[model samples]
Target: MSDDRPLDPVQLDAYFALIEVSSLLRHTVEQQLKESGGLSYVQFQLLATLGDAPSGRRRMTDLADGVVYSRSGLTYQVGLLEQAGLVTRAPSQEDERSVVVTITDAGRAVLATVFPGHIAVLRELLLDPLSDDDVEALASVLDRVRAHMRSIPPRSAAPRRRAPTR
Candidate 1:
């Protein structure tokens, strides 16, 4: 069913601006993560999420939900982190079918090393352009949007990863 309500010109402008800015921000962060720690942006996101968790661990599905990645893609990134000795994965005690991933001390060290630069980049690229009021409004608006998005059933965050290039 389609709604017959008219679209506002202001909403169209905001929608396009949001899309363009988000794309640019993601690209910039991907480049920064690659240069800083030889990490893909999604890898850094996984590490950061695990690092910030109270238990320093999360189930595979939970990690998949928390980050912009698919379950299989998250599994792949977890494997990379495991191979790098930055994290560990084991069968969950509560649910044998679910895997639990935990950030290691090495993961924390990597975050400590990289977080400062991450903040600097965020400030320079996003925050510096906004006034205090603008920042507050942006945060409030985005938080509302995020809540709306989360209320919907989730789909794959993006296309599944392709085979690596030689």
Candidate 2:
């Protein structure tokens, strides 16, 4: 009367604990963003990329890569931020059809106010006791997770297709 269900206890417990920890830490970071930055976790990620880019800007495609979003999805997010005046979009000089997104002064202000608390929350929640070796090992495992899951690109973004001119 055995069922086909496979609940290997040891494996299940380890996986469940890892996921619980991940979610707990994510929630802590998100809470900090709301309290200090008034932004969501996704918004903070977008703002952080824009903050680090040259001229505080990057192509929509590039932003999508940084945020692990589809190009269209990131465009929509950027549109929302643009409407809020936290981001601005312009035609890329190097590629007329591609859009460049820049963080606005207001955006930077929010980041400046929120990012410190965000990092603090992250450290307190996840990193306080982690050794340098642990961090490197975690990074290795995360990279493997991404590779194994195919959740992110296995390769760079597909090259943009040029429009055919008449």
Best by TM-score: 1
Off by over 4 Å in 2: 1-10, 147-166
lDDT scores of the candidates, listed in order: 0.89, 0.84
Tell me, by lDDT, which candidate is best: 1
Tens digits of per-residue lDDT for model 1, 88-117 = 999999999999999999999988877888
- TM-score per candidate, in order? 0.88, 0.77
* Tens digit of per-residue lDDT, candidate 2, span 36-86: 967777778899999998789998877877777767667777888888899
Error of 2 at 106 (Å): 1.9
